[model samples]
Target: MSNSHYDTSFKGLCYVNRVRMVKPSKSDPYRAVTLSVKSGKRVSTEGKGDKPEFTIPLDCKVVGAQAQAIFDQILEEHWDDKKPPVISAAFEVGDIYPDYYVGTRDKNAGKTVPILKGRLLKLHDVYVKGERIDTPVETADASDADTPAAAQPETASAETREDRTVDAVAEEAASFPSVVRLSKDDPDFEERKARLKAEGYRWDRENKAWRRPAA
Candidate 1:
């Protein structure tokens, strides 16, 4: 399949579980961490009552310096805790793919099932047990701080600054739109469609636009 067709991004609220650091091995020499994330929604049944909440399990590998630092702290703080930490975050995952395997035991001994997998790319607005964990921010080095303003990099031009200010205003104005309109002739249609889907936008055929209910 073409790479463009693959859903390369996903974002949602999930329960981060089973935090473990993987030691370097012959097969994979890099040090890494794994997180068992469960994300989904509850559905209602007509007259039968509410059906069980369906969840997609993603065994995602946590990589990159920022994400590793966050998980490293989590490991250090809760390594001895019996229960996994209750974590909620607006997170993003990338390089998603499906892995299929045969059932080894119980109900369907020989049945094949698929598991969704991805790499944990980012975690935002994270909270652990109702308390927020502030994401670390990068700061200038002490040496750079001591440098005079003249030694610092040149600032943006007035035109460029104005454009950026306008962009910031526009972005802030539309925090989350109720609908996203797209056309088949649009150059970035597929890319935008994939992104909108990841952001919980569903196609509204009647309205001829992608719609996401107000949260």
Candidate 2:
């Protein structure tokens, strides 16, 4: 696909299940490595439940210093824990493209697979056996849940609290940004409320907020 056809940035926590160096082929002069990754919010699941997995092929020849550091860390974890590392990476697809293949031994011989041609922009974190250890990104927001109320602004009005909550919740719902809390007094609230409940939003009667997991 063209560069404009794909998203500018791709972010996810990919659990590496396996890694191996690929021998150079006639079409490609340099060797490469394939990272078999499980798609999930976190690798702690150990690839359990309903998460899907895929293989991302990265050229090892030009992985650069940053990518090499992450690869080295992953190799260390693999050797010590005998388990693959969970790597969080942000990817761009400007130079990356899909490659079609056809082989007798291949399951989907005629299908195409996306070959990551761009260098790894950043290695956000690494996990061993589902436990996070190394992280390069700021995690302050993650600790907000445990922050003391006294540390926050107490002078903010109720309307301000409601507005902030709505904005925060809206940003979290990247896929379903239309999701919102409706009051019981609204004419169609009862009808739509039931559907939201079934979809996993929990009604917080005390706070008057309907919350679901962030996107």
Q: Please name the candidate that would achieve the greatest TM-score relative to the true structure.
A: 1
Cα displacement (angstroms), candidate 2, residue 132, comes to 1.3
TM-score per prediction, in order, is 0.48, 0.37
Clashing pairs in 2: none
Q: In model 1, how many backbone clashes occur? A: 0
Candidates in order have lDDT scores of: 0.59, 0.43
Off by over 4 Å in 1: 1-7, 23-25, 29-52, 103-111, 138-215
lDDT of 1: 0.59
Best by lDDT: 1
- lDDT, candidate 1, 1-215, per-residue tens: 12233326777766676555344555542223334454345567888544336556676776433554455445534434566667766667777788977999998589997787776766777778768887745333211334345465658876676554777976864786887787769999779876775564544433456667344
Candidate 2 residue 76 C-alpha distance from true site, Å: 3.2
89: Cα error in model 2, Å: 5.6
Report residue 139 deviation for candidate 1 (angstroms): 9.0
Per-prediction tally of clashes? 0, 0
